[model samples]
Target: MKTIYLVLPCYNEELVIQDSAIKIEDFLRELVDKKIISAESRACFVNDGSNDSTWDLLEHLCETNAFLCAISLAGNRGHQNAMLAGMMMVKDRCDAVITLDADLQHDISVIPEFITQYKKGYEVVYGVRKSRKGEGAFKKVSGDAFYFLMNILGTKIIKNHADYRLMSSKAINALEKYGERNLFLRGIIPSMGFSYTTIEYDEKPRLAGESKYSLRKMIQLAATGITSFSVRPLHFIFFCGMFFFLISIVMLIYALVVFFHNGSIPGWTSTVAPIWLLGGIQLLALGVVGEYIGKIYMEAKHRPRYEIDKVIWK
Candidate 1:
């Protein structure tokens, strides 16, 4: 039997930590009882510097539960960074690691399937949602748009898959080599070209408290994923510029012909309209280029992804 470690990244989840911890501990015990995993398997909760009493609750849980451990970041480092911190910390300690949300929205029941796949020689197992039946209207639309954009932009990723998945020690070690400042795990893992598989599972509703991913954060995540994985957006701007340049050449020819035939230029509206349109296009192009530049700048700085403030284990 392999030792499995569950890495859950949490931020401001005080409302659901205690209950979620109990449920997760029970599930781990059940898996052990069934001989699905080793008795030494552990659940590692990562505190992404939550302002609430989430870390305190984790300390209390760790004191009482042998299977539960905790990692606290120096400060809130976002979901991706916090998850990376926990997984990197425990990769050497476990045979495989499974990452999921602290809110229990990721179905814990399918975890056995992940281990089964790992045992069957799949190094990376992605937990893909079977359907978005329960998502809000805005969430559904935005999610659809993000995936659509990713597809159109030539980013190879498993649609409808979040950060919930299992990674064997080998796969996790391979992941540690990637030093992307703008981290997008969903896109990066597929690009690894490892022997991977997907498990379809139904996503459950949040156990408690509202979701931390607000609209701003969602957009930020999408942008990071896009800029990190695909250069097609930058190429798109170049193509648009070439297209407008061709149009301008044709318009200039028409204007010269009209000026020679009637001794006057084209209408003011025609000239002004294109000026305004091209101006806006120029600004949009600059903004897109700036985003890429910003990524390069951040990467050049070579900052640490996260810092661990404390860790607890028995």
Candidate 2:
């Protein structure tokens, strides 16, 4: 039986942490009893510097339940970094690791299929949402747009997959070699070219507190995913520049014809329109380039992704 570790990244999830822990413990116990997973398996929660009683509660839970443990970050390092920290911490001890959200939005029942896929020699197993039927209009549209944009930019990501995935020790070790600070795991993992498979699961609603990922955070994540994986945006700017140059050449010819025929120059509207258009394009291109430069700046600092303030294993 393979030893599995459930790495759940938690922010301000005090409302649902206890309930999630109980459910996880029961599910894991069932798996252990069935000999599907080793008894040494554990459900590890990474507390992402939540400003609540989350850490204290986690300590209590770990003390009472052998299946539960937690790692407390010194500060909020965001979800991706917290998940990375948890996986890295437990990689050596577990045969495979499955990542889940503390909000319980991802279907935990599909976890057994993840293990079954892993047993079939797949190092990476992605849990993809079958549909976004239950999501709000804005969320559904944005999620679809994000995946579509990623595909158009050739980012090599699973269409409907998020962070819910199972990675073997081998896959996790390969992932550790990627030292990027601006991590978009959804894209990065697929680009690693591992033996992988996908399992479709029905997405569920949140069980407790509001989603920690607000509109701003979602936009930031989308931008990170796009910029980190593809330079196609920069290439797009280049093509736009070429197209505009050709248009300018044609306009110059038209102006010369008008000048020769009517003995007059173009109107202010024509001049101002081109000026504003080019200025906007220039600023946008600069912003995209600046994002890449900022990523490079952060990565060059070689700072730790997260600092462990406390660890509760027993």
Candidate 3:
């Protein structure tokens, strides 16, 4: 049996952290009973400087559950870095590390599958969502558009896959060598060159707490992901410049045609300039729109929205 450490990153999850830890403890016991994971396997929760009682709850959980551990970051490092911190803490102690959120929106049932894939010599296993059936329409569209745009910008990412993934200790070691100041794991993990597979699960409703990732944060993450993985945005800007240059050349040709053929003609520039300008502007705008439409068309049939981050549990 393999020793697997599940690294759950938390921020302000004080309200439900205790209950969530209990749930993970139950799952850990099941794995231990089946002898699928070693008794040394643990659930490691990294507390990212929460102001509430999160760290205290985690401490109590560690005392009560043999397979539970906690790390308290000196300050909030947000979700990605907090996960990284947990992985770093547990890397030497375990054979594999599985990173997920504290709210348990990432279905725990598929965790056994993660261990199965790890046992098969796969270095990484991604937990992918089958659908976004219970989300709001705005979140659905925006999430769709974000990944669509990211792909268009040339970031190779598994659609509908969030941070929920398992990495072998060696893979985790390889991941730590990346030295970029602004790192996006979604972009970095694929480039790690690890053998990987995906297990699909129906994304569950958040068990507690409001989502920390707002719409603004979503855009920020998308931009970071794109910039980290690909320079297609620069390619896009260069193409736009070339497009304007072509329009300018066409206009200049029109001017030269009027000057050489009909020098005596009046109002040629005035007549053609507005028409060319408006037509060029409209075409450029439509071209930009079409690029996005092409992006959407590329992924419209693929994966569902990736994260919900919030759910008002009754």
Candidate 4:
């Protein structure tokens, strides 16, 4: 029998943790009863420095349930890092790991299909959402745009896939090789060469608690995804520079023609256009360079992505 570990990352999800825990426990029990996985299979929760009773609940769950294991981070390290921390902690103990959120937005029913895909030699199985049932139209549109932009930036991501996915031990082992401080799991996973497949399922409404991802976080995530995977952003600035330089040269020739033909004309428009255009171009170029430099600064710091404040296992 294969041992399957479910790694859930929680950040101030105290309201939904208990329900999430129960649902996952029930799912694992069903899998065991169906002989899909060994009874030794467990659900591991990584508490990402929740200020509430999330850690306490995880500790209690770990104590009461033999299949529960909890790792509490010292401070909030963002969702991707927390997931990475959980995977790193349990990659050695299970045949495969499925990382999911604590809100139960991702359907747990598709997990069996994920395992089936794994058995079929897929090292990675992504849980792709067939539909976003509860999200607003604005969110849906924004999400689609984000994916489109990511693709344009040369980051190949599985469409409609979140963190809810199954990864074989081999895949997890390969992932461990990536040690970048800006760990974007969704982006990074696809970059790791592996035979992978996807299972489509409808994303359900959260049973409890609001989504931890804010609009600002979504924008930040988009930026991280692009900056981490592609140099296209920097190249975009180069293209912009070339375009403006060409326009400036054309304008210069036009100005020279006007100067020779119609002598002594005060043309403020010509003077202001190049000044504003060049200034904007210079600032934009600097901004792009600064983005990469900022990332480098963070990497040079060599700080731990996440710190574990506590652990509970039984």
Query: What is each predicted model's overall lDDT from 0 to 1?
Result: 0.93, 0.92, 0.80, 0.88
Maximum-lDDT candidate: 1
lDDT of 3 by residue, 1-314 (tens): 78999988888898879888999989999989999899888888888778888877777778777778887877666677778878877899889999998999999999999989889989999999999897799988988987898777766788889999999999999987875545589889988788999999988888877877777877767755766666566566568768878987997888788889977656756867767876896676666556445555645565321222211111
Regions of candidate 2 where Cα sits further than 4 Å from its true position: none
Per-model TM-score, in order, reads 0.97, 0.96, 0.80, 0.94
Please list all clashing residue pairs in model 3, or write none if there are none. Answer: none
lDDT digits (tens) for residues 144-164 of candidate 4: 998999888878899888899
Candidate 1, number of clashes: 0
Q: Let me know the TM-score candidate 4 reaches against the reference structure.
A: 0.94
> Model 2, range 1-314, lDDT digits (tens) per residue?
99999999999888999988988999999999999999999999999999998888898888988899999999999999999999999999999999999878899998999999999999999999999887789998888888889989988888878799999999999999999888889889999999999999998888888888889988989999999988999999999989999998998999899999989876846688779989999999999999989999999999988899999986
Positional deviation of 152 in candidate 3, in angstroms? 3.3
For model 2, where is the 10-residue window of minimal lDDT? 265-274
The superposed Cα distance between candidate 3 and the true structure at residue 295, in angstroms, equals 25
Compared with the true structure, what per-residue lDDT tens digits does model 1 show for residues 56-173?
9999999999999999999889999999998999999999999999999999999999999999999999999999887889899989988999999888899899999999999889
lDDT of 2: 0.92
